[model samples]
Target: MTDSADTLRARLTEAGRVCGGWCTVHIDFSEDRENPEGLAESRRRSVRDRLNRMGADDATVAAIEDALSTPSGLPSPFSRFLLARDGEVAVDEAVPGAARGETLEVGVLPRLAPLIATGVDEFPYLVVRTSRDGGDVAVHRTGAFFPESTASVEGRTDTLHKVKGGGWAQLNQQEHVEELWKQNQQELSAEVDRLVREVRPRLLVVSGDVKARRLLLDAVGQAARSIAVELDANTRSDGTDAARLDAFVAEQVAAVEQRDRADALDLLRSRVSQERAAADVGLREVVGALQQAQVDTLFVDVAALDGETLLALDGVPWVARPGDETGDAEAVGEVPAAEAILRAALLTDARILTATQQATGAGAAALLRWPAASVTGA
Candidate 1:
């Protein structure tokens, strides 16, 4: 179990059931590897400082400190760390290669909400590379493989051909070789299709022998091809340069992520004029749509989260505006507006896209699952 939005939301919901001081920590393990322990200690201090500010009991704070100090028990080298503990109940998981920087938060159930939101936006993908003889397929997210789903296929290659003098014989051998190659391509394509359906990757990367890649692409459905990102480098059954391959894969992933983010922003902008019902711009409107569980996709500006305030009234998050009142409910506390929006989206199962280039003036927008009028009676 990787730390996905659904997993984090489920865990956070479960933690919410137990009423106690919860500690959440986000750390980047990618910095200063030569002094990993030093980084860990620094993050620990940060977490402790936040816990102290929260006015948590000494024993509860101590428990959280002990949990962070212990090993994460993850098999891979994770870039981001998220740990939440409330008394005896604890949930800690490593997010592999997703954290861009270090952050720490200590609060109630949704303290690590930002991490979950960003994890979903990482855009996990599947890469399939095939040749006439065989192929390999693997699922990757934020530069790390899922490991269990990584697979390969092998087939026989025909190398036997007649001499030049035997024209007809040579032609016959060529046809046989072509048949074998076609069969290999079909088999590889089917495997790739199966993985695509199983993984439902945000992007598909295909590379290897030029002819084989073309044949496999033709064999696969158009839907898979639509998301496919073609690469020039061919990976062999016998391993290739590890560093070079890693760099290539990372570059492709980054490209796809940027493209997707741009597309999402474009979609929101395009829909604003012709289909006002489908798009909601600005923070309050987006929050309103989210509260009704009508948002299909949430587009948040990368800097939207910073310095924005939200009110958490009885565990339900509301966007903070001047003179806003809880009415019959009592306000629990204030939280980051971005985190509140993200938590609401996760709970409603809406997709999130963080925009880095284009900024919606109010810092956020949303494409609703239903028309705005239907949800808000506009």
Candidate 2:
């Protein structure tokens, strides 16, 4: 029921706490261009059949179908995600990292680990292809089905062509043209600056003329320049090399995530050495910390949770492992380890981070809100 991005994770996991189970789905609309709708229904029907075989109740099956019934009309190369309970959906929207095929799950918790592992950014961003005359900008946001906005920032066009000869007059004209290019960049950058402030984009990607990019860097003020990454592209709308541009975009995006992970790992290492450390290492330990609503950040390889289950109880101290409990929390059966951890993290408002590299020897780690000993005075 929450609409704020700040509390989305919490909203998702709150449903997990009271819901008996979930029906999760990720359907890629682009994989079958010929019959996208049909493909989606086929996949849904398969899950429908499976659920029916399992003797799932009518309400749960209907909830799953109703959730999946809404199709995203976004363009190709996009995917959608849905998570439903007995008769209501908690999460339903478009997302990045298009699955190669239909992925459906009926489980103990909402299947959100795979999506989180895709490094979904929760903020808006701008991608621009600029030239000396103007820039083409596309605004993108997390879970947005398509580019949220687009703008063409054009300035004076008369000064774009450069002079080739070397006479005093030509040299003067060349200087004039260079100055005009700067003016054009200033105009484009001003629009970009406005957009950045309005949307508070997490990053800005500018690609086009080298000279224009330099001018943009100079003109854009601190806020925009701080997150701007100049792509080595010589495109300006027309005749854009689609393949090359996609490759560059993917590479830059991956690089940004890598830098973020590096910083997190460094902090994790530094914190772990302290006497009253606010960090937990290993999947089991992290899960234990999550039960206390103590996790501030979680680091893990999503792959590690595959085919693995975690011991959990139905109520307080929701997570546990063998030889690790002594209370009256009733057993809730084995739950998917990844979903359990993800659910706990979400419920407790913890940041879920996919550790692309090794975080610890145990395939998972977390920076807790407090030291382990402080949690429930264990």
Candidate 3:
């Protein structure tokens, strides 16, 4: 089974109960300059160094070492190494999707809650380029790229001769040629709509014949046009500049990410002003809403995940103040507030959106599935 955010959350919750040590390691496999053997060895050494710095117990360290020594036998572009031991609770698996950069994390529980929240950062997008007669389309997700679908439309090839360059016959033939081009555009537009519905990409990038592109755009629905990013560069079905295409896609992806973040923040601000129950701002309110499975979309500052702590009271997480006396007061120590909230969101199957500090000044906020009662009452 895939190691999704839900599975990771369940594993962490189960592992948290076990009385033992845990180690989490994240390695970037984006470097293609080195050979496979050398890269694996380097990653292993890096994990060992991180473990050594933590001064982990012998059994825990041995388990991690053994797990790392054995290959997964599957092609994994990214790496997330997790190991825990408490009478047989060992989590050793390589996560499939990760962005570029080295992220090494080790803690008593899997320090992967934040990663789950940021999963959307790797969501796929569709790229389509139309040609004179046909077009090529591809899907890009995470670090993987694959062709999704293709389209083709035939147009008039023969040239019509004019009678002394002024004849109704020549004009009629020109209109016929234009009609064929319109038909081609219509066919491509229908295909685009189908692909968008199936893939639900975060962005749609289109580049190719200008007239065809315009006609297709006009034919496509508003939803498709809303997310579409038109490229002015020349492209064809058989030949394409790989480097230039990659750069263009990367730039569009960054722009889409920025827009998404800004939109989430804008919604948060709007909701806060209205004092709407469906939107929550600040840590305490957001945590409470999450615990109730009321959150629809959670917007959290990346820095906030490591800034605050939450106490687990009778296995239920809560954001308690210094002298607050709630429940049995039987504290189960403290866990990262971000992790606790993330765990709750996963359990409820809510969407998680990571925002910048400037966007989420209160550390965390959430859009609820339904209106929640006042936090004071809860």
Residue-level error in angstroms, candidate 2, position 136 = 2.6
* Model with the higher lDDT, candidate 1 or 2: 2
Residue-wise C-alpha lDDT for candidate 3, range 29-110, written one tens digit per residue: 4334458767767877777677778866556666665666665554445554464553232454455555444555454455
TM-score of each: 0.76, 0.79, 0.69
Enumerate residue pairs that collide in model 1.
none
Off by over 4 Å in 1: 1-20, 35-78, 87-101, 113-124, 141-145, 157-172, 274-277, 302-305, 315-330, 356-358, 370-378
Instruction: Please rank every candidate by TM-score, starting with the best.
Output: 2, 1, 3
For lDDT, candidate 1 versus 3, the one ahead is 1
Decide which is better by lDDT, 2 or 3.
2
Sorted on lDDT, best first, the list reads 2, 1, 3
Worst 10 residues of 3 by lDDT: 155-164
Model 1 / residue 222 / CA error / Å: 3.1
- Give the whole-model CA lDDT for all candidates, comma-separated: 0.66, 0.73, 0.63
Candidate 1 residues 234-318, lDDT tens each? 6664555445666677787777777776787777777777654688988888877876678888877646557877665554333
Residue 256, model 1: lDDT of 73
